[model samples]
Target chain A: MFRYILRRILYMAVTLFIIATVSFFLMKMLPGSPLKAEDKLSEEQREIVLEKYGLNDPVPVQYVRYIGGLVKGDLGISFTFDNTPVTKILMDRIGPSAQLGAQALLIGTFLGILLGLIAAISHNGALDYTSTILAVLGTSIPSFVFAGLLQRYLAVEWELFPVALWGTFEHTILPTVALMIFPMATAARFTRTEMIEVMGSNFITTARAKGVSEYGIIFKHGLRNALIPLVTVMGPMAVSLMTGTLVIEKIFAVPGIGEQFVTSVMVNDYPTIMGTTLLFAFLFVLIILVIDLLYVLIDPRIRLTGGES
Target chain B: MSKLLEVKDLKVSFNTYNGEVQAVRGVTFDLNKGETLAIVGESGSGKSVTSMALMQLLPKPHGYVKSGEILFEGEDIVKKSTRDMQKIRGKDISMVFQDPMSSLNPTMKIGNQIMEGLIKHQNMNRTNARKKAVELLELVGIPHPETRLNQYPHQFSGGMRQRVVVAIALACNPKILIADEPTTALDVTIQAQILELMKDIQKETDSAIIFITHDLGVVANVADRVAVMYAGKIVEIGTTDDIFYNAKHPYTWGLLGSMPTLDSDEEELFAIPGSPPDLLNPPKGDAFAPRNEFALEIDTVMEPPMFKVSDTHYAATWLLHEDAPKIEPPESVQRRMQGFSNTGSKDGEK
Candidate 1:
């Protein structure tokens, strides 16, 4: 078990390194130059800006310098955001994004699982039909579109929630819903399929034959096995929700890394863009690793010598 | 000789897109107290369906019992409500399935699976249930019962898992135990161990067992009386000696002849010709008539009613008609039957 954990950690480190390398070079490869944004600046000023950020050096040299600075916990300065260090900017916005993402995931997963259980138990009944329809709507409609609709009706007409901005928990309602739609749909569909399959398995028949109650057969025997596949997708689903919430965050003006990432990309802010990408990639990798560990916990079958794929 | 369970005119069918598949025809059997009745048949012979119907545990929306009266301890189980049925299940009657791995919940610990019935039907608390679970495990012949209780189903070997299943079935001291091909999935050595364990447990508990399988060898060892099912109906049923020695049904004869004998000089064992009739469009008369070598003209025109060969022996065959000529069995079969009877008598004497 210790060896399994050790291997997972080592794999995580390698994954992080790959993400950092890709993000660093990809930011450099974007078409627009960072200095070009300050078009009115004199030749000397432009040269000074390039020299300060080490952009005057070759790409390889700049990469080495950037990696060296990263080693020292320095994220350098944002090109377009009044010379602020990218790490400082990320630190300020991580809270709202993390909050919104966690809320969305929690609400989506809980409700999805509940709805899925109802759907599976009811089977061909109204609950199952309703859940299927809801999942379809959630998956088909994009978060941005959902956010826009919520802002128009729920916020504008009915006035159920604030239209934009992040402060109190009330401000999180629209954007969280927007962020939750896809994962909720995914969770519902996955749980429903898994639950139905598990319910049909021979073990369930064995359970029923034992004179176990229908509820016991479902929750204890059926649901536990059904959760294996759901848990497998949880890592990628969570990270996707957090990192991909940029459109929702922007529409709602929620101060998150997603919003920061949009601003960094728009202004060609090299340091901020690289930092956010690296952080998001790191978070994605970390969540996936955590999910791998969780798989072993949920189902011991995966805790075999080599570890799960 | 009081009947513990009686199944009357049981018929089970599944509704598919093409048509209704009649999996079980008018099958009837009775289990007496402390008696082990083996229902022997090839695959798709409806032995499992008959058992599942008795418990009212058939899968819904597709498969259902068309007509049946499963009287368990004098009450009609088919007419009982789901709630009443729950009270009967696990408490009065329990079942162990063919696949031990699939029969157990993979996610659950072996102990909890065993304790579930105790807590549900017996109203035992968690603490008491756990203690009883260890005892039950030990009772089923599993070692280190205390530590093993914490392990999941996957941790145990195939035979051990079956033992765990047996322990779970016996947890509430059920009156009737239905073992549906329990030893089919295990290796030969494990199969013997499970059979011995079951026989031992049966002696202690005195529970009537419905042992369903295709292996005649197992039937010879475990069954008190044997029912040979064909297509969906019981073609023959008798005491082990009666079935092996004075078997009346042609299907039963075919089955016995198909089995390999040590003394037979034939290079290859005799095999029953043709496959089981498709349940979707079964024959109008006897389902096994086309395959029976000794089939009479009436065998293809009408289904045979049960004919009593002795006080405890009965068979469904047109050849058993009163005016029908007395035909001798094959010499090879007679020789094998003599050998079997001699060995069985010796064992009984010992």
Candidate 2:
């Protein structure tokens, strides 16, 4: 097991490097230049800005310098945000984003699994139909639309949850729901379909034949096997949640990394853009690594080499 | 001996989108204590369905026992509530399914799979159940019982997994063990070993076993009495000796002739021509009339009830009617019958 974990960690490092390199070049290839945004400034101001960020150097040289600063735990400085270090700005805002993302994931996965199990067990009954409808609605409506509708009716008209902000628990509710809508829907649909398929497998029939209770058959035998497919989706789902929270954060006025990421992109703030992209890429890689490790824990059949030992 | 299980007029059907498919139609049988009764039939002949109905394990909302009286020790199990039926399952009537790999839980240790029933039904404590689980592992001839107890189903071979399943079924010492094609998924050598092990276990436990299979060779070795099923009904039933020797039903004759025998000189074995009748709109009279070569005019118009050839032997065929003309089985079947009779005489002399 220790060897397995070490191998996974080594793979994670390789994966992160590939992501960083791709993101670096991809951002450079975008239409607008970070220096071009200062067109309204005088030649002297632009020169000072270019020199300060080392952008006066060749693209390869700048890339090397950026990678060196990244390795030393530095993210240079944000061009549009009063020239503060990009890392410091991100660190300050990361807490709200992390908390919101965690809460949304927790609530979404928990309720999704619960409702999915209900749908599978009750199969073709009212509960199944209702959950299916709810999942469709959750997936169909965009997060911003969901947030807008909830803010309009649940907050504005009924005056239940606060419309916007990210301080108290009440302020986080609307944004969390909005952010969770897609993940929850995807998880529910995946889990429901997988559970239904697993429940019909021969092993479940064997369990029932052994006089194992209906609950035991469905949960103990069925759910664990069903989770293999569900686990595979979690990595991509988390990445989507982290990156896709831009619209949700804007609507709720939540000062998250996604909101900052959008702001940085609009102004072509190179340092902040690079920092947030690296952070998002790192998060995606980490989630995928965790999910890969989880495969072993959930199923003994999957070895580190991806074959039965 | 007293009857241990009596399934009378048992009928089972599945409600499909097309229509209701009558899977098992008016199947009846009795199993005596310490005896092995084999139900022989091809696939979809309602052999497995009949056994599932007896255990009340039919898939609900789609499959159900339309009508039946499954009496275990004189109590109607069919009429029992689910809560009450739980007491009988695993405790009184246990079943070993066809596929052993699927039968055993893949994730759980072999010990826990065996101990599950002992813990739940027998009310044995964890420690005691664990100890009993080891004994069961040893009982089923699994080597290195201590080490194997911790191993999962995937670790074991096919035959070994079946042994683990059988061990689980025997955990509570059920009065009747229903083995539905238990060795069907095993290799030839392993199949023999499993059958022998089952016979030994049956001797030790004296539990009446209901063995369902399509293999005639398996019936020859393990079964005491055999019931030949064709198209959702028992076409013939008798002692193993009677059915193998004086088998009366044309379907049984077809099955016997179709089977490859050790002493047969024929280059080609007989094969039954037509498929089983469609149960959605089953034939008006005999379901097997279309396939039976010796089927009479009346056989197509009226279904023949069970005709007693002896005190313990019965067959469902119009040929057995007093007024009907006598017809012998084909030349190859008669020759095989002669070979079997010679072998029977030689064995009797010993």
DockQ of each: 0.78, 0.56
Worst 10-residue lDDT window for candidate 2 chain A reads A300-309
What would the per-residue lDDT of candidate 1 be over residues B1-350, giving only the tens digit for each residue?
Answer: 89999989989999998899899998988999999999999999999988888778988888888997888888889898898888888889999899997889998888889999999998999999999999999999999999999999889999999999999999999899999999999998999899988988989999999999998878888888999999989999998778888888877877787777556676356678999999999897789989877777887888889999998999998788987777767666666677788776413522
RMSD of each: 2.1, 2.0
True contacts kept of each: 0.72, 0.38
Candidate 2 Cα RMSD (Å): 2.0
Least well predicted 10-residue stretch by lDDT in candidate 1 chain B: B341-350
Docking class of 1: medium
Task: Tell me each candidate's TM-score.
Answer: 0.96, 0.96
Q: Which candidate has the highest DockQ of all? A: 1
Global lDDT scores for all candidate models: 0.87, 0.86
**Alpha carbon lDDT at B227, candidate 2:** 98
Candidate 2, residues B1-350: lDDT per residue as tens digits?
A: 99999999999999999999999999999999999999999999999999888888888889998997899999998898886777777888889989987777666778888887888898899999999999998889999998998888888999999999899889899999999999999999999999989999998999999999999888878888999998899999999888888889988888888888776764488999989999998898889999888889998888999999999999999999999899998877777666777777324322
Please report how far candidate 2 places residue A138 from its true position, in Å.
1.5
